[model samples]
Structure formats: C-alpha cells, structure tokens
Target: MQNKLRIIGGAWRSRNITFSDAPGLRPTPARVRETLFNWLHYDIAGKTCLDLYAGSGALGFEAASRGAKSVVLVESNAQVCLSLKNNVAMLSAQQISIAQTEVSRFLAATAQGFDVVFIDPPFTKDLVPTTCLTLENNGWLNPHAKIYIETERSLTLSGLPANWQVLKHKTAGEVAYQLFERG
Candidate 1:
C-alpha cells in the first residue's frame, strides 16, 4: 500500500509526497513537523542534515524544502528508499540524497558532519539510546548541531549525551517529540 503526506512549509509547502506502507514506518505527524520547523526556522538554511530511519522521508524533505544545503535520508527498507528517491526526483531536490542502508551501519561509516539531524526510529525497538551514543561518540555532529527525536509517548529518553540540551519538547497523541542542541 502507499500513503501520502504533504510538506507543510518551505518552498515545497503544501506539496504532497507518497511513501510505501512499510512495517514500523510512521511519518512524523504534520502538526509535529510544523512545530519542529518553526523551532528550526533560523537554523535550517544552508545546513547539512541527516535523517536516520528516514521512513517516509518527511523530516528530510522538509529540511531540503526549507533550504538545507544537503539532506541525507537513511532507510533500511528497499521499498521505502524507492519512494524517497521518487520524491527527490519529483521535487528536483538537488540537495537531498537517499541511503538505502540500516541506520547503525550508515552512522558507523559516515565521515561527514551535519548541522542538524532527525532521528525517528521505530517504536519499541530500543534503538534511540545506541544511535544517540554513536552520534555523540563519533564525529557525526558539528558543534551546536540540532537533533530532533520522536518516539512513543511512554519511551523514557535516558542515556542521551550529557552535552545535548533539550531546547523544546512536546507531545501529541501517542508521540513525544523533542529538539536537542549539542553543546
């Protein structure tokens, strides 16, 4: 099956994109995305971004539309990756690229640093802590990089890096989303 979502802001505002109905894939809700982008309005332009567990490519696409210099979307599923590639081509998004690989593998091998990163892994797999640690321990983030994380409401965000400070947090329905700034 295919599902559709709209880009709520930036140059591609109101444009709709499609995604495969892959298991464990939940695109960030529009309201949550709106809030996140608003919080990042001043920081997005000309920035490099990483969207781990890219899923529907919502966050990545949004960043690109908003003027991020580059956006790399990492998704393990082939179908999802295809959808993301299609959208990138459809939008002629020169700044966006799709990586068809597991998040951990991509993180381990990534050599470049990003100014912003979006991490919205599948629920109940306990992937966030390890992913956070890898991003911190490795040289994946530029100084003062902004990280956005979305998880189920019940998931406790523990063991995150000490230098990361929560700049914003909000809950909508079952999802809890936050913006953290790397010190």
Candidate 2:
C-alpha cells in the first residue's frame, strides 16, 4: 500500500496525494511517472491527453499540472471513481475531467482524439495488450498519437496494429514502460 502520492512536476511540484492500495490498485511510482511523462511530452503544453484506467488519476493530473490543454481520466469502479473525482476536485485542475466508465466504454464513447494516451491497466490481469488493441479498434487514437504503455514485465504483446510501433521500451522494477507511435 502506498501512503504518499506525488505530482510529477509543474505548478504542483511537491504536491502529494495519499493513496491506499485498495483491491486492484497500484499507483505508479512518482519517479516512474515523472520519467514517463518527461519522455512522452517533450513539450506537453497545449496538448490533449487521455489516461485510460486512470488509477488514482495520478498520471492524468500530472499531465494537467504540466499544462496539458485538456486531460481526461476514465475509471469504471464506483469506489475508485469517487476517489478519483475527489482528487481531481482537490487539485482544482480546470483542464482535467473524469469519466465514470471502464476504458472500453470510454473509448467507445469519446470521439475526441488525443495527442497522448497513457494506458496503465491493472498489472495482474495483464490487460495491456488487449487494451491497446481495443483502443485502435474503437478509434480512440489519432493516427500520430503517442502511447505510454505500462504492464507487468513478464507479459508478451502480440497482434499489435501494423502501424503502431514501439519508439522506446524500458522496465523499472515490475513496471514495464513502452513508448509507441505509428510506424
């Protein structure tokens, strides 16, 4: 269980969100989140982002804090969604929005494409690859959008969209980070 959550950078530099690891939750570590955004958003200002499976909304709020023009965080679980809403309100991030729906539903509903899409589904279920496929199938992504994928290091991905290719891949502890773009 993580006791402290942090904003990666920007106006809320040292801000912390107290996170308790409830069932099916593992918030990304501060260092990893910071590094992930740094690589993905060379200059995130004015960019739009969608954070799928936004556990705790850590990554989504991080983008908004860093000056993303619009950031949406989607979560289905009622309890988690409530907490996510509270966190978003607490941060008072005008650019941020929260949707109470699973990733698939949100993807199916939103026609708004994003410059960056951060996918950090539950690691235990190993849903990262399926989520990636669904996103492409549901047309949630722009042709040139960048993806930040996090998954357990042991999972192997297959059947990726032909045009989607990895730009950078790395592992920190159990979290594997893959930065992907169109081929």
Candidate 3:
C-alpha cells in the first residue's frame, strides 16, 4: 500500500509526503505528530535534530518543517532513502539531509550532536534501547537533548542511558511513544 503522512504544524503544515509500501515502513500517525511537535515547541527552533531509522522520514521532515536548523534522517534501505531525498527536493527543504546507512553504522561513524533525536526503528527489531544507548555513548546528543522513542507496546526499554528521564509517554493502539530528556 502506498502510504503518506501530512505535516501537522509549522511551515510545511498540511503538506502531504508520500512513501513506498516497503515492509516495516510505518509513518508516525498525524495525531501523534501533532502531539510530538507540541512537546517540542519550546526546544525545536534553531536546534539540530536526528531521525534514526528514518523509514518514511515523517518525523525528520516534521522537525524540519517546524524550524529545526538542521535534520539528519538515517535509513538503511536505499529505496526509502531515495524517497526521502525526493521529498526533500520537492519541498526545497535545504535544512534536511538524508543518510543512507544502517542506524548502527551511522551512529558509530558520526560525532554530530543533536538537540533532539527521534528513534523509531522497525517495531519488531527491538532497536530502541540499543539505539538509545548508542546515542548516549557515541556523543550524538547535546547536553539536555530531547529524545523521542516510538516502539511496539509489547517491547520494554531496558537499556537506556542512566541519566535520561521520560518526560512524556502515551499509547496509540499498539504503538507506545515516549519523549526523554538527558540530564
């Protein structure tokens, strides 16, 4: 199925972005994007952000639309990365960049720091905790950076940075999402 998501707020508000029917590619729902942006309003402007496992680029594009200075969207799949690049070009989104690499490799190779990070790996992969730990250990997060995590409700986050604290959490059907702040 061809899937699409709309930007819920900021300059790209209401703009539709299309994606392929790639397996494991689930965009964040509109309601969830709205709520996520609300939580990020105070910190989003002019901040750098990372969207790890950026399957559909929904969260990364949303961050760019809402005034983030820059956004890096990392995805392992080449087709998905191509789609993301196409969307960026279509929108003339100079602030957004695409990284076509596996999340682990990208995290290991980059020393870039972000004020905000979005971690939404494929739900069945159990990547949340390990990705979180890598972000912390690899120095990808700036001081007090905000991290947004989306996972299957059945999965438990057992390996996060010790200093990180959950600032918000909610469930939408089988999806469980949380926002964290590193202290």
Candidate 4:
C-alpha cells in the first residue's frame, strides 16, 4: 500500500509526498506538525536537523522545506528508505540526506551535532528515552538543542536525560508529543 503526507508549511507548503505502507510508519499529523513547527519557529532556519526515525519523512522534509541547512533522516526499513528517496527526488530537496540504518547504529557511528533532533520511534518499542541518552552521551546534539519526542500517552519519561527540559508538551488521542531543550 502507498499513501501521501502533505508538507503543512514552509517553502513546500501544500505539497504532497508519497510514502510506503510499512508497519509502524505513521507520519505526524498535519495539526501536530503545525504545532511542532510553531514551537520551533525561529530556530529552524539554517540549522542542522536529525530525524531519528524518518518513517514517512514528513518531519524531515518539512524541516528542509522550512530553510533548515541540512536534514538527516535515519530509517531502518528498506522500503521506507526508498520512499524517502523518492520524495527527495520529487521535491528536489538538496538539504536532505537519507541514512538507511537503525537509530542506534547511526548515532554510534556519527559524531555530528544537530541543532534540532526529532525522535519518533515505533510505539511497540521503548526506544525514545534510550535514543535520547545516546544522543546526549554520543555528542550528536549541540548544547541547548531542541529534541522532539512522540510516544504513547501512557509511557513514562523517567529514562530521559536529567538536564533535558520539556519546552512544550501536548496529547492527541493516544499519542503524546513533546519538545525538549537540552540544558
């Protein structure tokens, strides 16, 4: 199966990008994206971004379209990676790069720091907090970097870094979304 996710704002506003129907590949809803970008209003332009679990590439593409200097999308599934590539080509986005690897592996190998990091792992796995720790310990985020996390509403965030502060948080249906700043 195939589906489309629209870029809600920025240069690519109103554009629709296709994605594969891979399992656990839920794209962030338009309302959520709008809210997230609003929270990140002035910080996105010319900043480097990391989408830990690219999935439908909605968030990464939106960042690129919004004037991010560069956006790295990391996805473990091959099918989803291909879909991401297709979207990149379709959008002619020069600021986006795709990494066909797991979040842990990519973080372990890369020492680059990003100004913004999006962490939306599959709901079945408890990877958000662990990934957050890895990003902190591995130096993958610049000081005061913004990290966006999405998970089940019932999950506890006890595993996240001590210095991280929730700048914004909201709930939609069964999902909980938050934007944190590393202090």
Per residue, candidate 2 scores C-alpha lDDT tens digits across 96-144 of 8888887877766747768889888886776776787877877778778
Tens digits of per-residue lDDT for model 1, 1-183: 889999998999999999999899999999999999999999999999999999999999999999999999999999899999999999999899888999889988956889999999999999999999899999999999999999999999999999999999999999999999999
Per-residue lDDT of model 3, residues 39-113, tens digit only: 888999999999998988999999999899999999988888878888999999999988898898998895888
What C-alpha lDDT values do all the predictions have? 0.95, 0.79, 0.90, 0.92
Write candidate 4's Cα lDDT for 1-183 as tens digits: 889978988999999999999888888888989999999999899999999899999889999989999999999999999999999998899899999998888988959999999999989698987899999999998999999998989997778999999999999988899999999
Candidate ranking under lDDT, highest first, comes to 1, 4, 3, 2
Top lDDT prediction, candidate number = 1
Better of 2 and 3 by lDDT: 3
lDDT of 3: 0.90
**How many backbone clashes are present in model 2?**
0
Show where candidate 2 strays beyond 4 Å: none
